[model samples]
Target: MVLEAAVLYVKPGLEKAYESAFQQASAIISSMKGYRSHELQRCLEVKGKYLLLVEWESLEDHTIGFRQSVEYQDWKQLLHHFYEPFPVVEHFEKVDLT
Candidate 1:
């Protein structure tokens, strides 16, 4: 599985709207191919910071399958405007320790 992570810095005073928009946008991503699961976490210390984590079957599932699809446009329209400077998204693969 590939883990997609992003630190979202929402515009101040728009946290509630951002969250609401995220709620609406979740469906867009969840329906995509290779989507496993996702979570949105609000920072306790930071006022407008959030952590977004999504699990995909592979990098292509996100970078290509989702990003290239029509649903991505809706996702962007719903949530992209909430970001101030935009977030940096990164992907990770699990390492077995045992």
Candidate 2:
């Protein structure tokens, strides 16, 4: 599985609003092809900070299948404006130690 990670820096006073918007946006991503799971974590020490992690079957599943889909637009509209400088998204694979 591919793991997509992003550190979201929300606009200061809009943190609560962003969380609420994320709730609606989550449904859009969960319904997409190759979607495994996703989580949004709020930082305890930092205000207006969050970490977003999403699991996909492959990199293409997110880079192409989801990003290029019509549903992504809805996802963007709902949550994109909350970011200040925009978050950078990256993907990774599991590093087995056993």
Candidate that scores best on TM-score: 1
Instruction: Determine the C-alpha RMSD for candidate 1 after optimal superposition of all C-alphas.
Output: 0.4
Please provide, for model 1 over 1-98, each residue's C-alpha lDDT reduced to its tens digit, 9 standing for 90 to 100: 99999999999999999999999999999999999999999999999999999999999999999999999999999999999889999999999999
Return the top candidate by lDDT. Answer: 1
The residue ranges of model 1 lying beyond 4 angstroms of the native Cα positions read none
Candidate 2: minimum summed lDDT over ten consecutive residues — where? 76-85
Candidate 2 clashes between residue pairs 3 or more apart in a chain or in different chains: none
Tens-place lDDT digits, model 2, residues 1-98: 99999999999999889999999899999999999999999999999999999999999999999999999999999999999889999999999999
* TM-score of each model, paired residue for residue: 0.99, 0.98
lDDT agreement with native, every candidate: 0.98, 0.96
Clashes of 2: 0
Quality of model 2 by C-alpha lDDT: 0.96
